[model samples]
Target: MDEVEVVVAHSERATLRVGDMFLKVDADQARIDAEVAAMALAPVPTPEVLWRKPHVLAMAALPGTTVGRLGGPSTGSPGAWAAAGAAIRKLHDAPLPPWPGPGRRPDELRRELDEECEALVTNGVLPADLVTRNRQVAEAALRPWTPAFTHGDLQIAHVFVEDDEVTGIIDWSEAGRGDALYDLATFTLGHEEHLDDVIAGYGTDVDLAVIQAWWALRSLLVVRWLIEHGFDPFTAGCEVDVLRSRM
Candidate 1:
């Protein structure tokens, strides 16, 4: 993999391309190694290849820029969204090994929401009452479902496409067993206009209200993050618009 000199190396991960191997470094490789192994054992059409050694090397490369960089109308096209849904279905259908990490509990999720909301309120980006109300809604909506393996960060940026089809998914660091709807929620909230397409692609008759609740919760979560980070008011205001529309 050293054939292509290191072009970019972050503190936590490095990107290297040598021949057919595109390697990414993980300070903690055990989880990723397990995830990859699980993918291999399951019947799924994912990226092919493996590690040369733990933290020493890993390899797999597919041709195509991230879907995010290919900013065409196609990014939000029905075909693209359908492809993404199909990809997610494949992942969800894969048999996951028993997860070992501290899973996201309702109380823990609530605590995180409260902390983020409090930070946003303290930063003067949100009203205390609004945060409280959103928190309540989030807690209630999340109560009905049990956790499952979810792609924690399932945004358009993480999707990969080649020859007009989704070929592979990247960034396995956030992969974990969590509320399955959380993945669907992220996809739908970010692509509201394509909700029908996404739902159809998933091939499920999910409750509309539950889906909307998840969408609202995801939007509030993002808005809370942006606000806490002290982003420009314009950015925060745009997030507010998204959050409001869902409610």
Candidate 2:
């Protein structure tokens, strides 16, 4: 039997790799549905959906290593970053999916931001003033946006590259219609130093302020979740470091 490697296992979800197959197990059925739907709609390369059960999704593994990791220098060439940028552009321009769910709704997101900010400050997980500043910066991203196909969680690890070209992107559970810049922001967060390389390939005008705002907003909101999931956000170079850089 092929050894089953635990990719990541948390209370809400887990991923395991067995030989050539990657299996995702999540208690949330809707998320699995959204991932399947979005991958079917996206124009960019994505893992091939093999089969799915109520709590499990299986996909054919793609070739190539990940583009990079957060809080670490990317070994990928600038051109690969550009290629990823170009892929994002293509996805954003493609036809919208038949149905985009309640995506980053203004009211809901505001409530979430407020709650998460309060939690961070109250828990002493982050300095109150730092949370306050980032929350304020997050105001820029709270405004309405023309929805576009977004990889909802476009972290660097989700993008795969081979020979300076994007071979595939994984983790579509967060994929949906939302702010295009949000995807860019999430993809570039913790690695702001590479913004220029990405933009050079994106070849389109983007609001830097909004992107920066998202970096702060997303970091602030996800810190608590990371803590609960057995991940550390305050380690030397992690989400907390990303937040501190903004200060």
Candidate 3:
């Protein structure tokens, strides 16, 4: 057997290059990759796709890795962040067909919260009361709004940066119609100082308070997930602190 070149590895999936083709796999996660590939190529004006073999193989590898060197000091430059913000704006502005299905409603999100709470309890990571409280706060905060197509897991790690510019955005499995500000909030929550630059780049007059609320809610959810999955809590806690400072 030959060793495949590993492109990226996450808790959910591992991307590897086998000969001329690329393969992505996880425990029963191939279906998700197929769905994401379909959505990404659905006249969305995103990165060009080369080829795909059902849910198992998808080819298109850009040169360069995510920003910030491994085990090194934070190299997330402000200029790079500004460029990424602009890239996000372009992505959001792209015309996407109305998402199918019932879409994300507040009631549905509340049910998801309940499910997350149960998962956290089963993992014994945090007090059940904490999860419930966080969910209640998030639900109440998100209730007064409509949803839109958003990159559900927008973060620095998902952005491919080279020479202070974003070459591409990888990982679309979490993309769906939810809230317009969801991605922005997720990106800017930890790096609050970059919010000004991102907002300026995005050139939107949306309510800052609402954006801040989203940031808080998203941070709480991220923390809950991290704890449940036994991941590091430091990063999520830092984001939560940033949101708290703004509040």
Candidate 4:
């Protein structure tokens, strides 16, 4: 018998590993449906769905290790990182999903950012200067963007690689049409050193300022949420550090 291993657990969702299979338990069936649909539509490699039962979806594990984890050193080589970038480019180039997906609209995102920033300061979660400076930096990302198919939460941990080749990208609950730069920023959130390598494989020129702005914006918006979800965004090399780097 395979011992069950808790991959991740929070209020909204949890994932468990039993033998070689991963079981995702989500409170929102719509998110699970979206994830399944996005995986079907994505051009890149994705895990094979073994089965599904209402809120629980079981999937065959993909081969290879995650590119990296936030707050940890990336074990992937430059080639692997470039391969991840190439995979992301393919996903972005794919046709948009019929549904709006999970990314917030610019106006909506602005409101959320402002509210989160105010709370962070008022609740003494972060210093006023830090919040203010990051807010200023984040403003650049609030501008309109032409939408592209995006892995809405393209965190480094979601991308898998083996021998400098991308094998799979997992966790598609947030996949949708959004700013392509946001995906890039999310993938390299704390690993900014790899941006040039990713750009080399992305095979296009992108606005560095916009990417940087997205970093601040993403970090600032998610800090409180992360804390509430039992994630340590304030850890060294994590979201808080990412915001501080902008200051």
Model 3 error, position 84 (Å): 1.8
Cα misplacement distance, residue 209 of candidate 3 (Å):
2.6
Give the Cα lDDT of each candidate.
0.60, 0.86, 0.59, 0.90
Which runs in model 4 stand beyond 4 Å of their true positions?
1-3
Residues 12-68 of candidate 1 have per-residue lDDT tens digits of 556576777667676777756755654554333455656646764565766664434
Of 1 and 2, the candidate ranking higher by lDDT:
2
Question: In terms of lDDT, which candidate is stronger, 2 or 4?
Answer: 4
lDDT of 3 by residue, 7-57 (tens): 666566666766544465655465456346445643333344555544454
Q: Cα deviation in Å at residue 57, candidate 3? A: 3.3
Each candidate structure's TM-score, on Cα atoms with residue i matched to residue i, is: 0.72, 0.94, 0.69, 0.97
Q: What TM-score would you give candidate 2 relative to the actual structure?
A: 0.94
Model 1 TM-score (2 dp): 0.72
Model 2 C-alpha lDDT per residue in residues 108-181, reported as the tens digit of each score: 89999999999888888999989988888888998899999788888887888999889888778877778999
The CA-based lDDT of model 3 is what?
Answer: 0.59
How many residue pairs of model 1 clash at the backbone?
1
Off by over 4 Å in 3: 1-11, 16-23, 26-50, 65-74, 101-103, 114-141, 144-147, 235-247
* Clash count of each predicted structure: 1, 0, 0, 0
Against the true structure, candidate 4 reaches a TM-score of 0.97
